[model samples]
Target: MRALAYFKKGDVHFTDSLPEPKLTSPKGLLISPSFTGMCGSDLHEITDGPIFMPKDGETNILSNESLPLAMGHEMSGYVKAVGPEVTKFKVGDRVVVEATISCVDKHRWPNAKNANTPMCDACKDGCENCCDYAGFSGLGVVSGGFSETMETIEHHVVKLPDFVPMDIAALIEPLSVAWHGARVAKFTEGKTALVLGSGPIGLAMTLVLKARGAKKIVVSEPASIRRELADKFHVETFDPSKHGERAIAELRSIPEGGNGFDFAFDCSGVAPTFNTGIAAIHYRGVYCNVAIWGKGINFNPMDMTLQEKNLTGSIGYTVEDFKQVVDAFEKKKIDPKECEHLITGRIKIEDGWEKGFLELINHKDTNIKILLTPNNHNELD
Candidate 1:
């Protein structure tokens, strides 16, 4: 078996003659990947170096102790072999694996508010994703999608519709992220939405909002290239050319505006976007932060107090969120133009190292989601 393995520091490459993963569970299934998406977070971990690895004390939870860590998570594949305990799916069923991997017995949410660490009982008993110390696949926390063949627990697998193409099924993971975030925002019919950033996550949020029947959608993106892409998706694009309060003013006055929108989502992970996303929301409105930022920034307590808006932070999705995202595509709720345009490029695994990685990091202005098609011996690359 050939797997793209990440070893040592600042290194990941494809390697041949790796040992094949054994079927270890009664309900487990093995899949030969069709397509795998190279995520930004994967690049972050690669560039951030090794000290900050997501490990559980002595154990490296993200990347297994085994050398040559597997490198993908966003993917879809067909079931090659099913365990005896698996009844819902057969050997030839097309499926998309939910990438989140948690301890079978992990935490629970006790009314959404409380105080504690890993042993909060509810945290371990509820769902691994909600646990503060929950482990995830593809982030080096657990093994991922970049292998010719790999095993997945039946609990994390979702069956895909026959009508959806395999390439489209590869998008279910990120769409789940967007679907979870938009559902949290509470946007509905006749409500306005302002999305910051025209990157993959931002555009994903917009599509979900549009599918959910948002009345008007406005976007604030600094890059003109991304702004044009947003326009192609039929979202009302706005430039973040002006700074401070002026930027918000120019954006809000789009259709002779007053006050602003019912919901705003910050997908840029930039300092200004975070502040402005909240400022652009109406009184008692909802603001969802879907971006991942490692640094801190200031926020005015007075603004939050006076506005009385609900601020929510969304993490990864639940099993239910994954289902909703897949069903949206299956039902054609998400537009085809919106989906294809966002997939800026698709390269083979061999092209991923420098060409694909550098383009995404240094040349962020030109691309969105660059997918990597699996180059398995049986599959056509």
Candidate 2:
């Protein structure tokens, strides 16, 4: 097995002769990954830089890499094997790895708040995703989709219908992320939405809003390509560069002079976007934060109070989000060319650390999500 691994003290690199994972119980599936997208966090884990450095000497979401572990989480693959315990899935099925492993425990069900709180809200009664014991992958703590293969619990896999391409399946994880935000917003077909970024997450949000039947979708972005892509989707795009307008100003011009979005999803997690979300939401509207902004900033709670705006946060997705995304793709709603447009570059697994993952961190403005393919890894070669 040619697994892409972190060269402990050096840049990320791979080696030949990686060990194959033994088949576990019936609860697991062994998948041969077809495509894996390099993520922002993977680069963060490899660098000893700020933001997400390794802690406890062995665990940074990227560096704690369970060394030499394979990486790549946003991916799609074919099930090569299934444990006897698995019931719904079978070998040769194309699926997207959901990338979270969890089990139930009481005192932590239906949390709906605080994902890292070491308790499952759903697990207390047999529901997971909010389980008291939530185990997530691509955390740099667990083996990832970067390698040629992954042994994931059956529940973590979402089977894609035949109509969806394998390449598009790689996007399921991130699409789920956007779906979760929409879920938090409690979107209905006729509601208005504004996605505050043109990045991959932001673009996904735009896609989701359209599929969910948003009456009017506004995507605010400065990048030319992203703005164009949003336009291609028939979304009303707000380009910040040309107008120098804040998000609030853009929405105000829509018709109602700042009546605001029914559901505002902040994808940039930037201070400006936050302020805009607060200022532009209608009364009783929901503002959901899905972007991970690390610092706290000054904002008037009075604004939220006066408008009756509901403030909420969504972490990652439940398995249900993944399912909804696959179904969206199966319905021919997810355009393959549009999905591939989100990809800016592709690199071999061997170059992932130094060249691939590294580029994701330093050159974000130039790329959306860089993908790493085992198509060039030595084991397969």
Candidate 3:
């Protein structure tokens, strides 16, 4: 089967020599992936990793995988085969793969099935996203969505509606990420929000907020194309570059009364954006960190304390988050027309670097959600 594999930092290659995956567990299913979306984390992995992608000779405690890893986690596929004990899914079931792997008991079955297996206090508390040993399936597990196929535990697959196209279905994973942050911040209808960036995750947050009935959404970004993309969704946009020293003040003015936003999300993961998000929220408002930060930084806790504001961090999504996103689409809260706009373009696995990753990295402002299909290429819609 053809697959995209990592050779070293900044190098991902296409290969047809990798062996086809076989169902190894009674709880596993073989997925013939139709579409996969590249994620920001994937970019980080290819560029500077060995971060999440395991090194040679070192096994991941959860998936037991090492280097030469398969990439691409945001994916949609159809079931080609299933293990003997798998009852919920059968041949030809369309589904999306959730990349998070939990439970990971090293002493027992290190790479054992962890779908419904809660091995941590967080998972035990119904917060699997907070699971201590949570590892991504694509980054370090068996293989990823970049391949022609993936062998995933039944617990990690969610059935997709027939009405949902595979192209759009591939977005479930990333959308679930934003959905989880909204859920964590307890976002309510008619509330206002400030998004720190207009990248894919930030844009997804706007869509989730709008579908959830946010009264006013303000997306702060410097990139004109990104801001324009957010504007197409009717979201009010602010360019921090335009405001300069008064960017926070300008952001505060977007919501009613110039007081502050009801909720703020930092999706850029930069220090300035983090500070801006913290400063832009109303007193007692919730601040959520949606991006994966490059490095930890020092911030004054007094800023959080004086306003009695809530600062929380959200990582991967839970099974429930994916379910809610699917439900959002089904209920028509998220318009398919609008969601489709998020998919800027598509490329073949062979062109993953030039057309997909490099294009995104260099011209990120003009692109979003570029899907990589194993079979063929897809031009911008």
Which candidate achieves the best TM-score against the true structure? 3
**Candidates' TM-scores?**
0.88, 0.85, 0.93
Better of 2 and 3 by TM-score: 3
Ranking by TM-score: 3, 1, 2
* Cand. 2 Cα-lDDT: 0.71
Lowest summed-lDDT stretch of 10 residues in model 1?
A: 106-115
The lDDT-based order of candidates, best leading, equals 3, 1, 2
TM-score of 3: 0.93
**Would you list the C-alpha lDDT of every candidate in the order shown?**
0.73, 0.71, 0.83
Point out where model 2 deviates above 4 Å.
7-10, 48-65, 104-119, 125-135, 241-247, 255-258, 375-381
Backbone clashes under 3 angstroms, per model: 16, 16, 0
lDDT (Cα, tens digit) per residue for candidate 2, span 55-163:
3355432212334556667878788898887898899887888875554211122232332454445755534555544545544434567787777777678887776
Score residue 113 of candidate 1 by CA lDDT: 22
Q: Candidate 3: worst 10 consecutive residues by lDDT?
A: 104-113
The residue pairs found clashing in candidate 3 are none
Error of 2 at 80 (Å): 1.5
